[model samples]
Target: MSASIVCSALGFRWPDGDSVFTDLNLLIGEGRTGLIGVNGSGKSTLLRLLAGELTPASGSISITGELGYLPQTITLDATRRIDDVLGITAQRQALAAIESGRGTEADFGVVGEDWDVEERTRATLDRLGLGHLDLDRTVGAVSGGESVLLALAALLVRRPPVLLLDEPTNNLDLRARRLVHRAVADWPGVLVVVSHDRELLDLVDRIADLREGEVRYYGGNFSDYEAAVAAEQETAHRLVRAAEQDLRRQQREMIEARTKLDRRQRYGQKMSEQKREPKIVMGNRKRAAEVSAGKHRNMHLEKLAEAKDRVKEAEEAVRVDEEIRIRLPHTEVPPGREVLRLSTVELRNGPVLDLDLRGPERIALVGANGSGKTTLLRTIAGTLAPVSGEVALKVPMRWLPQRLDVLDDRLSTIDNVAAAAPDASAQSIRAQLAKFLLRGRKAEQQAGTLSGGERFRASLATLLLAEPAPQLFLLDEPTNNLDLASVAQLTQALTAYAGALVVSSHDIPFLRCLGITRWLHLDTDLTEVDPM
Candidate 1:
C-alpha cells in the first residue's frame, strides 16, 4: 500500500504548556485505519493535524492526497437547506437559472465540465439512507442521525482521497449505525476513524493504538490486537518469574560463597596462632587466599549484578493497567424492597411513563437522541418535574449526567468530594479517593484543569461519596466519551455498587456487560422488551 500521510518528528503543546506529542512519528498508508486510545491520548489531535486544522509545534506532516474530516460533534445551521450542507448550492442554482431561460456564458461556465451535481448529491444522500429527504428541506427537519448521514454525504460528494471520522456512531441508533457501517464498508478511499465502537472498529483494515503521544500499530481488528497483547503479556510474566528465580539463586550462592571464604580465613588465622607452619609459609598462604577470595567475590558480585539487571529487564516488559476497586455497602438494596415508583408520570413535552423498581434491578433505557432519555433521567433524579404526575422514591438517588458536569470547576477534586460528604473526615475522603487512583497532588488539582478521563473520575468520586448515600443510580450516557480502559475501570467500580440502576445508553454491549435484568425502549411510550 502507498502512504497517504506521514508525520515526522512531530511535537505539539497546548497554550497551558501541557505537552501532548513529542518527536512523534507515523506513516498512515492507503487503507481503512482505526485509531483507538484512552480518552485524552491525542487521537483526535492527530486527525486534526492530518486534516491541517492545527499546526504542529515542531516537525512536519506530509499528505499525498486531499483530506476531509468529520468531527465528533456536528453542528449545522438549522435554517439552511440540505444543498447548502452538501456544498452544491452554487451549481444547483446555476442549472436552475439556465433552465428558467436566464442562461448566460458565465452560467454555462459555472456548470462547465460537471453538470450532474444534483444527481450525485441525491445519489450520495440516498446511499446514506436519506433518499426521501428533499434537497431544499431545512436542517432542523432531519433527525440527529439523518444529520450525521448528511454530513458524511457532503464529504463523499467532495470525494476526498482521505477521510477522518471521530466517534461517528455516537448518538446513533442501531439502524443508523447499520447505515454508517454500510457506508464505511463501501468507502473506497483512505479512511481513518477514531472511535470506541467495537462494531465500527471491526470494519477497519488495521488498528492504531495511541498512548502517551506514541502510535503502536497492530494488524487486524480489536479482537486480534487483544489476543496479541495477551500472548505477549503471558510471555512477559513467564520471563519475570524466571528472572526472579535466577536472582534468588544468585543471592543464595553469594551468601554461601561468603560464608565459605570467612570460615577458611578463620581456620588459617587459627593455624597461624598455633604456629603450625613457618611465618613465611603462613604469610604466603594468607596472600594466596586473599588473591583467590578477591577473584571469587568479584565473580559473585558480577553474577549478582547481572541477575538484578535481568530482573529489571523482565519486570519492565510487563504492563498492568490500573483499575479502581470500590466498596459501597450503603448502596445495597434488599430483595422485594421498593426503590422507586411512578404513576401517570409524564415529561414536560415527552411521553408518559409508569414504573416500579425494586431491589437492585438494572434497567436499560434505549431511545434515539432527543427522545427524552435525559429528561426522564432528570425527572427520576428529582432535578426536573413532570407535567402532571407523581414520582415516589423509597431510597436516595444520584444521577451521572451525559456531560459529567457535576463538579464545581473551580474546586479541587478533594474539595469536590468533601463538599458532597461534609460530615466525613479528610483522612477518610483521601483514602477513598486513592482507590480512584487520585492521590496526593492529583487529588488536589482543580476539576477544571483535569483531562477528560481525570474529570470523569473526580465527578464519579463526588457522586459515589455523597452524603445520605444513594441507593439508586441514574446514569445518562455514562459510556459516551470514556476510553476502553476507563470503561473497564467503570465496570470494576460498578461491580461493587449494589444499588438499583437506571442507565440510559446507546451502548448495548456495555449495558449487557452490567447484567441488565430488564430493558425498556423509551420512545412515544416506554415498553419492556428483550434487549438481545
Candidate 2:
C-alpha cells in the first residue's frame, strides 16, 4: 500500500525549549503499524502531531484522509451523557425533533445525512462489547476501561480512514483489551498505535521503532521486531569490540613510535656530543629530525582520533537496557508472619472483600475495570476509608498508586527519596538511588523535569528505600504507562523485594513475571482464580 501519512523535516520542541524531534521524517502506510520506542523517545508526541493535536515547529504533515486520535489519558466530563461523549448528542436531539413533527431546517441540517445515527452508534458500541450501555448514562457511572472503549467507539463510528491510538490499552482489563485488539486487527485503513502493550502490538502488521530521532520499520509484529533487534544488537556489539581493539592498537603504535623517536634523538645527541660532524651540519640535522618527529606525531594523533571516533560510533549502535539492582533486605517478611487482614470489608461503590494475607505471599489482583481493584488497594493503604469494615496491617506498608503521585515535583529525586527515608543520610540515599538507575546528576534533577520513566524509577526508589522498610507493598496498575524496558526493570527490582506484594494490574504478563503465588479475582466477592 502507498503511504497514507507523511512527515517531512518535522521539528518539535516543548514550551520549556527542550527539543523532542528535529528535522525528523517519517512515512506510515496503509495497515496496522505498531509504534514502539523507549520512554521519552517522542512516540506520543509524534502521534499528537499526526492527530493534529500538536503542530510541528517546522516542515509539514500530509494525510490522505480524515484522522481520528485517541489520547493516552482519556478525560471526559463526569456530568456529560454517553451521547455527548460520543459526539452525537446534537444529532440525537435533531432526530428526536424530526420524529416529534417539530423539525426545523437547522435541525435537519444538524443531522445532515446521518438519519441512522442511533443505529450506527449502537452497532459501534456492540462491536466494542459495550452493547449494554445506554446512551443516556452519565460518563461518571462507567468504568475507566469503559470510558476508553467509549472514546474508541466514537472514533469507530466516524469511520475515519486514519486512526492514531496512544496507549489505548492502558488501564483496560483483559476482556476490554481483547476487544480493542480485535478492533485493531479488523481495521481496514491506516492504523498507527503508540503502545507498550505487547499483545496489542502483536496484532499489528508491522513495527516502527523510533530511536535517536529516527524511525526504522520492521516487517511483521512485535515478536518479529524483537528478534530482528536482537540480531542487530549482536552485530553492533561485534562492531564495538572491533572498534575498541582498533583504538587500542592505535594507542600502542603511537607509544612505540614515540619510543623509537626518543631513541633516535638520543643517538643524534650522543654523536653531536662526540663532535662527529661540523656544528652547522649538526644544527641542520637536529632541525630536520625535529620536523620529521612532529610530522610522525601528528599522523599518529590523527589516526588515534579517527579510531576513537569509530569506537564511539559503534557503541552508539548498541542499545542500552540498564537493570535496576537493589536489595531490600529490611522489606523481607518471614514465613508464617501475618502481613495484612481485611474483615468483612465493604468498599465504597464496590463489592465486599475479605482477605487474609500472610508471609511473603505475592498476590495478583485481577478483575475487570470498575471492579474496585483500586478502591480495595486504597482502603488497604488507609488512603480511603471502607464504607464498613476493619483493615488490619501487621507490618509497615507502602502504596504505589497508578498515578505515581507519591513524589513531590518541586524537589529533586534525591530529595524525594530523602523525604521517604528521613533517617537515611543523603549520601546513602544517593547510592541507593543509583541502584534504581538514577545516578549522579540524574538523582539531583528535579522530579518535575524528569521524563515519565525517570519519574517512575524515582517514585519506585522512594517506596522501596523508605525508612522503617515496608513489609507489605501495594502497587496499583504499576505497568500502565511503562515502556517495555521499564517494565523489565520493574520486574527485576520487584524480584529482589521479599515483602508481601498485593499488586492490582491488568497486565497479565507482568503479573506472571512477579511470581505471584495467588491470583484473586474481584467481582461481587474476592475469589481465588486460576493463574492464566
Candidate 3:
C-alpha cells in the first residue's frame, strides 16, 4: 500500500508556547487508521495538521489527494441549507435551471458531469442513516448527532482520497454509531479517525497510538493494539523490578565497601600510632592505603550511579493508568427505598411514560440520535419542565450533561467543588479532589485552563463531592470524547458510588462496565429492553 498522508518534522505549539509535538514524522498508508491517545496528547491536533486546518510551527504535510476533515465540534451555520453544506447547491441549481430551459453556459459549466449529484447525495445520506434529512432543510433543524452525520455524508459524496474525523461518533446514539462504523469499515482510501469509541475503533485496519509526541503503529484493531500494549507493559514492569533489585544490590555493596574501608583505616591508624615501623615507612604505607581506599570508594560510587540511572530508565518505560479512588457511603440508599418517580410524565419532545427507581438501580438509556435521551435526562433532573407530568425525587440528585458546563470556568477546580459543597472545609475538599487526581497545583488551577481529561475530572469531582451527597445521578453521554484511561477512571469512581444512576449513552462497552441492572430504550415511548 502506498502512503496517502505524509508528515515530516511536524512541530506544533499553542500560542502560550506549550509544545504538542516536535520533530514528529509519520506516514499513513492507504487503509483505515484509528488514532488514539489520552486527551491533550495531540491526537486531534495531528489530524488538524494533516487536514491543513492548522498550520504547523515547523514541518510539512503532503497528502496524496484531496483531503476531507470532520472536526470534533461540528459548527454549521443554522441558516445554511443542507445542500450548501454538502457543496452541491450550485450543481443542483444548475440542473434545475437546465431542466426549466433557463440554463446559462456558466451554469452548464458548473454542472459539468455531475448531473446525478442529488441521487448520489441521497444515497450517501441514507448510508449514514440521515435519509430523513432533505437538501433544503436548515442545519439548525437537526440534532447534534445528525449534524455530524451530515458532515460525514458531505465527505462521502465528495469521495475524497483522504478523510480525517475527530471524535466522529461523539453525541451519536448506538444506531448512528453503527452506521459510522460501517462507513469506516468500507472506506477504500486513507481514513484517519480520532475517536474514543472502542466499537468504532474496532472497525479500523490498524491502530496508531500517539504518545509522548510520537506515533506507534499496531497491525490490527483496537483490541489487538490493547493486547500488544499489555504485553509490552508486562515486560516493562519486569524490567523495572530487575532494575530496582540491581539498584538495591549496588547500594548494599557500596555500604559494605565503606564499612570495610572504615575498618581498614582504623587499623592502619592504630598501627601508625603504635610506632610499629619507622615514621617515614609508616607514612608512605598510610598514603598508599589511602589511595587504594579512594579508588575502591569511587568505583562503588560509579556503579551505584549507573544502577540508579538504569532504574530510572526502566521505570520511565512503564505507563501509568491512574484510578479514581472515592467512597460515598452517605450516598447509599437502603434497599427498596424510592429514589425517583415519574408519574404519567411527558418529556419535552420525547416519550410520555411513568417510571420508578428504587435503591441503587443502574439504568442504561438507549435510543437513536434524535430519540430524546438527553431531553429525558434533563427533564428527570428538573432542569427542563416536562410537557405535562410530575417528577418527584425522594433523594438529592445531580446531572452531568455532555457539554461538561457544570464547572465555573473562572473558578479553580478546588473552588468549583467547594461551590458545590459550601459546607465542606477547604482541607476536606482538597483531600477529596486528590482522589479524583486533582491535587496540589492542579487543584488550584482554573477550570478554563484544564485539559479535556482534567476538566472532566474536575467536573466529576464537583458532582461526586457535592453537598447533600446525591443519591440519584443523571448523566448524559458521560463518556463522549473520554480517552480509555479516563473512561476507566470514571468507571472506578462511578463503581464506588452507592447511588442510583440513570445514564444515557451510546457507548455499549462503557455501559457494560457500569454493571447496568436495567436497560431502557427511549423512543416514541420508554420501554425496558434487554442488554445490548
Residue-pair clashes, model 1: 0
The digit string of per-residue lDDT tens for model 1 on 272-291 reads: 99999999999999999999
What's the residue-level lDDT of 198 in candidate 2? 84
- Write the residue-wise lDDT of candidate 3 on 221-282 in tens digits: 99999999999999999999999999999999999989998998898899888988899998
TM-score for candidate 1, please give it. Answer: 0.91
Model 1 segments more than 4 A misplaced: 1-3, 78-80, 94-115, 137-146
Alpha-carbon shift of residue 226 in model 2 (angstroms): 2.5
Model 1 lDDT, full chain set: 0.88
Give the root-mean-square deviation of each candidate in angstroms.
2.7, 3.4, 2.8
- Cα displacement (angstroms), candidate 3, residue 104, comes to 11
Which pairs clash (backbone N, Cα, C closer than 3 Å) in model 2?
A: none
- Model 2 Cα lDDT, one tens digit per residue, 1-532: 3449999999999999999999889998899999988998999999989988898999899999889999999988899999988889999999999999999999999999999999999998998999998898888777778889999999998888999999999878989998999999999999999988988898899999998899999999998999999999999999999999999999999999999999999999999999999999999999999999999999999999999999999999998888998889999999989999999999996688889999999999998877889999999999999999899999999999998999999999999988888999999998899899999999999999998999999999999999889999999999988999999999999999999999998888789999999999999999999997
Q: Quick one: best lDDT, which candidate?
A: 2
